[model samples]
Target: MKSPGLTLVSYGGKRYRFDAGALCTELLTTGGPGEFARYESLHEPADLLRWVERSRLPSGLEMPVSEGELAETRALRNALFQVVADRAHGRPLAARELAAVNLAAAGAPLAARIEADGSRGWAPGATVARLLATVAREAVELLTGPYADRFRECGSGNCGLLFVDTSRPGRRRWCAMEHCGNVHKVRAHRARRAEGDD
Candidate 1:
């Protein structure tokens, strides 16, 4: 189910929410080296957001999920799970640069250059590749650098949550107050009562 602490981006007049799944995919944590190496394996950014919005698990107080929705949600859950595990275990980063190069070469002189030069030396393909690589690298660097703190995981004990820390203080912890925050508060009150009796 939709966990707390996901990030949202506004692009093309639409708001795209990014959860652990998108982050892991963006970071190329899905599949083995070869799979991630092929950028085609990556889902479209919009699809990723749709997937996140559609998947949500019930917290303790909520009713149990229906069978159909449960299965669909679980599949989405598994996607993020595998990605997180890969990242935690230090899986190799995908060859995104190569993918970027291939994408940038579409409809350009790069295809002809490859045929002419036998894939060697400076050519249209190489130029496109270089430019694509530069842009991708810079984008990633900027995201994970100055805005590094904005990338965060949720702190709720019961949620498999992750979120971007976009709060003014960059101290955001919960994804939603209606869920995790209330759960935590109740837990704390119970804990305090127990402490008082002892």
Candidate 2:
């Protein structure tokens, strides 16, 4: 069975995981950071297929993706990352970066459909273009929405992942409480104990 919102992969003594809350943010986290080095999950066409299947994209894509399409997806992913990183750092997004995302998003055959529950849903073509479009739409929405103000980079050492802080108090300090938060807590506790002993 597919485990939604809890995909875990290990690197450098740390378990890199996804929260499935946001598609664009999750795309940026396919690689781990620091001494764990860059662990790219989408290294090949098959890898991209796995990611698409695992992510359960809203576009409902099933894959017989080409290597060229995978390359394009990776390029789009990098562009989205740059856009998000710039926005998080309070820097203005470059025109070229925005253009790249917009151009890819335009290629997807997306349409609004009426759902069984009388709600609107997006229906995208069953192609890599559709997947890229879905992800690009997510990035644009995140970067331009009111929630953009809540974007934060992980505060853990060398854990540079970005997340939207949805906490009621808006004081979230880690990407995942069980991951970086616990690490910081344990480190602080050890430091305090050592100081007391000294």
User: 44-94 in candidate 2: lDDT tens per residue?
Assistant: 788887776566354344556888997787778777777776777788888
Considering every candidate listed, which one attains the maximal TM-score? 2
Instruction: Estimate, for each residue in 1-198, the C-alpha lDDT of model 1 and write its tens digit.
Output: 345333443223433344432332233222223333332222433443343234331121112234443333233334433433333334642454334323433423312223353532233332323322332343344335654435444467444344434456766666455556666889999999999999
- Candidate 1 at residue 34, lDDT? 36
Off by over 4 Å in 2: 1-4, 12-17, 32-37, 56-60, 109-124
Deviation (Å) of 5 in candidate 2:
2.5
- Local accuracy by lDDT, each model: 0.39, 0.70
Off by over 4 Å in 1: 1-142
- Report the alpha-carbon TM-score of model 1 versus the true structure: 0.37
Per-residue error at 15 for model 1, in Å?
Answer: 19
- Candidate 1: count of backbone clashes, pairs at least 3 residues apart or interchain: 6
